[model samples]
Target: MTPKQIERIQNKIKKIKRALAADKKHWGGYYHDGQGLRYLPPQFYLEINDYSGAMRYFNWFNKNFEEDSGYPIFLFEWTITLFKKKKVKEAEKKALETFCSNTYLIDVFLGKDMLEFNKNESSNWEYSSLIEHLIYSKDQEELSDFYIWLENFTTSQTFYDFANKFIEIEKAINDEPMGKKRSQLFDEKLKLLESIK
Candidate 1:
């Protein structure tokens, strides 16, 4: 999620519900009113393990916000949730949706496909989310080849700008003292980075 999307999700949990209920008449399309609001319910529901609820929000999101800038984040999160629920086929479909929305994601999530990361953009938080998805799913594809390809692909100066920022974000996440989860994310990212050869 982008900073704006993350802020909205935090706001949804903190303030949006009360604002929406207290002023329903004034809140028409409230969830869809903002740049990233449409992603809130689906991600929140997924966080709580409400797959059906997540699916409902995902359905609505797909119908209404397919072209929204944040749609790829929603699709990626939804794909991870489906994979967590053992819905592999559905997850793959969602993964394809994510790829179609932004092929940079293909570089992050489907690295086994060996596609070039031609875009000049750097590491999106969505990339970390995709890494988490792969970790949680126990994907068996060898990481070394992907890392090699990614290293070479990311060598361009423009991509290096992105990669440097990615390292910063990765370090911050890894250094958070939250517990085993953050540690695992750190470990997984490190393992991949270390595999470049």
Candidate 2:
């Protein structure tokens, strides 16, 4: 596009940021009470190649809503932003979080057959599921390097080990009775996630 067109898009993004900020202030909640609006600024900033701006909004959203679940696409973009900033470990952690959020995403990206998995069990259609990944999947040509890195990382033996352990833990969690043993399994799961290298 022409410079004028780019400028117009930038101005529109600025307006959107202002409007979202105003709405959040008026509503008096954490990003409109956990609505998807929180992803807008970062998404827009990334589109405009404003990495710092995108990172700032991503940091704010994560800091304020650490306990809340993140959208798969949001986490994926955040991983890209972090990787661009040379934050490799943080990017890997976010990638793992994204994978855990939707196990089918990497498989889909890699063109692996997913027919063996029970689609009904993973069809949330909103968060952390194959349907959500399909809904959010878009061509990100500018992020090719990030995709390459992700492909390599996800295919690594280390990742496979972690993934297998995570699945085992999930199975144990589901099978164990609702008691201290189950709680310990949950703790083990959390530790395993945090232990991602």
Candidate 3:
């Protein structure tokens, strides 16, 4: 796009940021009052190659919006922002969290068969499902570098080991009767998730 068009978009994003800030101030810095627009600033900042701006908005949103149900697309963007900020370990951890929340995404991105994976074991949230992946998949070209890093990470031994262990625990949790064994499995799963870093 031309410089004029880029500047226009930047101005629009700034206007949106101002509006969201006003809403937050009106709400006394409690819940985010940006309607569904809360995820846009970070994403728009990322698209404009303003990694610091994206990270700042991400940090603010995450800190203040305790009731926000996360969007997988935004989480994916957050991972990219973290990487761009040179926070490699945080980015890796966020990638795992993003994958766990939306297991079909990377698989679909890799052109793998989704049916092979246990969809029943995946997140029940619509935003973290195959449909969500499809909705945001068009943005992949804009995020090609991050996707390349993700592709390599997902193919690594570390990722495979973690995924295998997670799947095993999920399967065990599904099969086990509701009692101490199942509870123990849940604890194991939590520990495994926390061990991603």
Clash counts for all predictions: 0, 0, 0
What candidate 2 gets wrong by more than 4 Å, as runs, is 8-12, 27-31, 115-140
* lDDT scores of the candidates, listed in order: 0.52, 0.69, 0.72
Residue 191 lDDT, candidate 2, scale 0-100: 89
**Model 1 misplaced stretches (Cα beyond 4 Å):** 1-32, 63-70, 84-89, 106-197
Residue pairs with backbone atoms closer than 3 Å in model 2 (clashes):
none
TM-scores, each model vs. reference: 0.41, 0.76, 0.77
Ranked by lDDT, top first: 3, 2, 1
Q: Candidate 3: list runs displaced more than 4 Å.
A: 32-34, 66-69, 119-142
Cα-lDDT of candidate 3: 0.72
Q: By the lDDT metric, which is better: model 1 or model 3?
A: 3
Weakest 10 consecutive residues, lDDT, candidate 1?
A: 134-143
lDDT minimum window of 10 residues, candidate 3: 126-135
Q: Which pairs, if any, clash in model 1?
A: none
Summarize candidate 1's per-residue lDDT along 27-123 as a digit string, tens digits: 6753435434445566566444456766665576566555554556666677666665667666655554555445555455544443433332334
lDDT value for model 2: 0.69
Task: Order candidates by TM-score, high to low.
Answer: 3, 2, 1
Sequence-dependent TM-score of model 2: 0.76
